[model samples]
Target: MRMVTKKQVPPLLLALGASVLALVFLLAFQGWIAHGADIFLSLAQAGLSWCF
Candidate 1:
C-alpha cells in the first residue's frame, strides 16, 4: 500500500467554505444566531476594554 500525503486547504477556499456554512446557519436560525452574536460581541468588547 502506498502512503498518500494530505494537501493543505488554500486560505481563500477555507474562508469561502466557512462563509458558506455560516450563511446556512444564519438562514436556519436567524433570530437565535443574531442574539448569540450580540452576546459574543458584548463579551469581546468587555475583553478588549481590559486590554486597552
Candidate 2:
C-alpha cells in the first residue's frame, strides 16, 4: 500500500492551463496568434487589469 500524500495543483487550474494551451495551439494553426499577437496581447492585458 502506497501513501501518496503529496499535494497536487488544483484541478481547475490544470483544466484552465490545458484549455489555454489548446486554444494557443488552435490559434497557431490558423496563424492568428502570430499575425494578431498584439491584438490578443492587448486583450489579455485589459482582462488582467479588470481583475484589479
Clash count list over all predictions:
0, 0
TM per candidate comes to 0.46, 0.48
Q: Encode model 2's per-residue lDDT on 1-52: one tens digit a residue.
A: 9997988999999999999999999978788646566766687887853442
Clashing pairs in 2: none
Off by over 4 Å in 2: 1-4, 32-52
Tens digit of lDDT per residue, candidate 1, span 1-52? 9999999999999999999999988787877666866766777878853442
- What lDDT would each prediction earn against the true structure? 0.80, 0.79
TM-score for predicted model 2 compared with the true structure? 0.48
